[model samples]
Target: MSSTDAPRRATIADVAREAGVATSTASVVFSGKAKVAAATRDRVLSAAAELGYAGPDPRAASLRRGRSGIVAVVLEGHLRTAFLDPVTTAMMDGLTDGLADLSSGILLMRDEAGDDAAALANAPVDAVVLIGCSGRARASLEIVRARGLPVVVIEGEAGEGIPRITLDNAAASATIARHVRDLGHRDVALVTLPLDSDRERAPVTDARLAAATVDVTVERLTGTREVFPDAPAVSASGSFIDEGVRVGRLLLADPAARPTAVLAQSDLLAVGVIRAAEELGLRVPDDLSVAGFDGIAVDGISDVTLTTSVQPAVEKGRAAGEQVARMLRGERGVTQHFTCRFRAGTTTAPPANR
Candidate 1:
């Protein structure tokens, strides 16, 4: 409440008066920095509850800091759709840990906005982290740069002297593809993330391949092709289990024509392919071999350990945060590279006919 009125929201001052203590004392009770007598603490809390005073306004501290104390994380798609990916969630967790020293809050935003970089322009944040380099992400990077704020990108092009957290997507994908190839999976199919910002689900063709803007998708695909040059590729709209299931059905509908193995870009997609195989009464690694990336444990596929490449997801986020912290301190931000480790599980085997 700004002034005396008929009814007003309670403030910490009001709670202090009700508790018969000084405003600073009531504030310290909420801060929990210093210890107070049990009786005094309870009295202050009870008074706060009675007056509907939760705590001091946190914005006041940010105001004193002279910065928003917020870090904006731009995702490639809708916030709801983006959060569903465990990879993104893990990266965010790492990012939070990295920013822990700063006590900064995260501001999740969409990379693709209806207007041209309007969201990035209007975001009240001290720094920005772009997850992927869609066309929109590139634009957002420019916007943040023009505003003279620090920027860090994960798994995308952070060229032009910007710091980036990179994954060896191509090298890792090649390793996994070689694992499949060495297992005699001559006839194989590939499931990929979106080729472009449109997130269109379709059979990857020369036109789609040429128009690809997502470096991660392209890098992973490139690596696989080094092993399976003629492997048929299907691009999902996004990295999701259901999207995998959808394309899995299309790829496996004709048993006679289906590839002996499916190399999905993500574990969730691989799990979806496994589900599609089960629905068709096909035995995994017996009738159809399925492999995935990202090394995440999908709840439904616990019985079968996923054959994938485990990337350091948390470390990626933490590294990004650390770079952001460096830039915030007026220091040069360094680009960091991460690699993936291949893990073989019960999911892969030599082709049945091999």
Candidate 2:
């Protein structure tokens, strides 16, 4: 043969011929899901070794059910910016575990896929999971729905007859807000996640709340207002420490108008607020109290335990994944709800003058 001419890759047929066994028998040995004689299995294995065969390629098998074996996860911000939150990573772990039966891989797609949808449109994904089913996510959901793909929404609404994995954002936020109120914090302000798809950092205005698309942010804000009816709120661009610091400074810049306590929507945001308080020469719980949501460990704010709500983030992701799997199996998916537990910590205290 010429140097450019190469031999065809060995196949299970070649190995079966070498082992003097039927192709079906050889396949069973490779699948290992059925019983076969030890001698026969050993013969097949030895033949496979001699032929340099590495079992069957899963790529062809994965398509047998008309599934690409890839679950596309659509998230609200840029993939790089969104993964900075520990909650996303934790949820991803649970999602991976829940989809293990499918042996599927995850495809992380950003909500802003309109500008460049070549990847989203052409990618051979079996199902789509929208992290939040609002605004841009809704658009993506519509695109996939048109393609007749199974979808699961986490923490956002996708309309009627769709399985949703929701969280008690409103109730949990209300509970923590009541905790702050019980601590004699009358002058309190809220640091919120983004209100809309724009994710602009600004003061939480009435119009903005009315037009909010992100359900989690809206629910948490509504819950907090249940306790502090008139508490001022500011929106953060994202759930990062830097956004928290910026919002914290904006809320606590003037001692004359500074809120006695600040309620952040996330732990990283809370830590950022605390760091800002330190930057402004204010001691936590003494001059200013800060609390956050999510039960994840934050790196900064040394020794300061956050007063916050711990939600089952990972479980939420798992539930979404399981629901998607159910839908893929032609079964009706069920909606699941999760609640956050309030954890009182040293970061919050009664108003100093109280």
Candidate 3:
């Protein structure tokens, strides 16, 4: 047909009429809701192909079902920064897989972006998934709840009645800490992720600990303290290598008072600590032992594998996504907990000269 004379887009009715079947039968062929005889289904599909009708409009179907078919993935920081973390990437992949059956797409947004909360409140999404939520992210809970959307939080507490996919944060950190302690590292220091919404990089004082709103950071710190009550700690602004380097320099610069070992909350921070140690002419695990969490691959950072805890990041994300799907489908969402494995890399050893 000529461009101007082209026929209108084909519809299910068109396919049904051409296939000599009812419109509902044609729809069932597409929705896979009811069983149609083999010959009828084949005829309907053939008619659809000939008419160039690729099933009903997804948007139209969603409208009919009263759903937006969009899931908002709320992160703690900017998108660029969040994607840099391997854990975030892994979890996102899993979430995508979990929502595969729904044929839904993800909308990445930050909880505390200038107007993001308001925008999210108005977005036409079926559900929201909060990744490692902090106080800043928690502040937007009211907005999401107000929209009457299903919520699934991963590694963050959103209070009762909200389904959460949690990790064994304290237990996993404790296991790693015990490994360091067993290495005869009497004098050690802790490098932590951000403790609160302020994202401060300074010594962790009791006041700051009490005010911390980041559940993951607080839980890891609790595990470390359980092993070393008197060990000094510095909270990095975020989980970036630069933040780790800055805090690492502060903790490792003073040779006289420098601890024999350092435990970082993330592999990136741990690598930064190693970089700091090397810049100060200290050999990792020889002059100053270093340990980290998140068993992410760090071949780019160093050859010395980082001793850390390997958590199922992708599974955590998938669980959250599955829960979101369930809630959206009028099913009860259940809380799930995951564990981590300890990796003994070359980075950790007995304290030098101890």
> Quick one: best lDDT, which candidate?
1
Model 1 residue 34 CA deviation (Å) reads 15
RMSD for each model, in Å, please? 4.1, 1.8, 2.4
The TM-score obtained by model 1 is: 0.85
Lowest-scoring 10 consecutive residues by lDDT in candidate 2? 113-122
Q: How would you order the candidates by TM-score, starting with the best? A: 2, 3, 1
At residue 152, what lDDT does model 2 achieve? Answer: 88
Q: What are the clashing pairs of model 3?
A: none
Consecutive 10-residue window with the lowest summed lDDT within model 1 = 1-10
lDDT of 3 at 204: 96
* lDDT tens digits, residue span 1-354, model 2: 788988777899999999999999999899888999999999999999998999886677887877788999988888878789999999999898888888889999988755636567667999988899878788888788888888888999888887889999999999999999998899999999999989899999899999999999999998999999899998999999988889888888888999999999999899999989999999998988889999898876778789999999899889888988888889998889999999999999998899
The model with the greater TM-score, 1 or 2, is 2
Cα displacement (angstroms), candidate 3, residue 119, comes to 1.1
| Tens digit of per-residue lDDT, candidate 3, span 248-287 | 9999888899999999999989999998888899998888
Give candidate 1 regions above 4 Å deviation: 1-58
Q: Considering only N, C-alpha and C atoms within 3 Å, which residue pairs clash in candidate 2?
A: none
Off by over 4 Å in 3: 1-8, 17-22, 33-43
- For 134-251, candidate 1 gives per-residue lDDT tens digits of 7778888888999988999999986788899999999999999999899988999999989988888899998889989999999999999999999999999988888888999999
The number of residue pairs in model 2 that clash at the backbone is 0
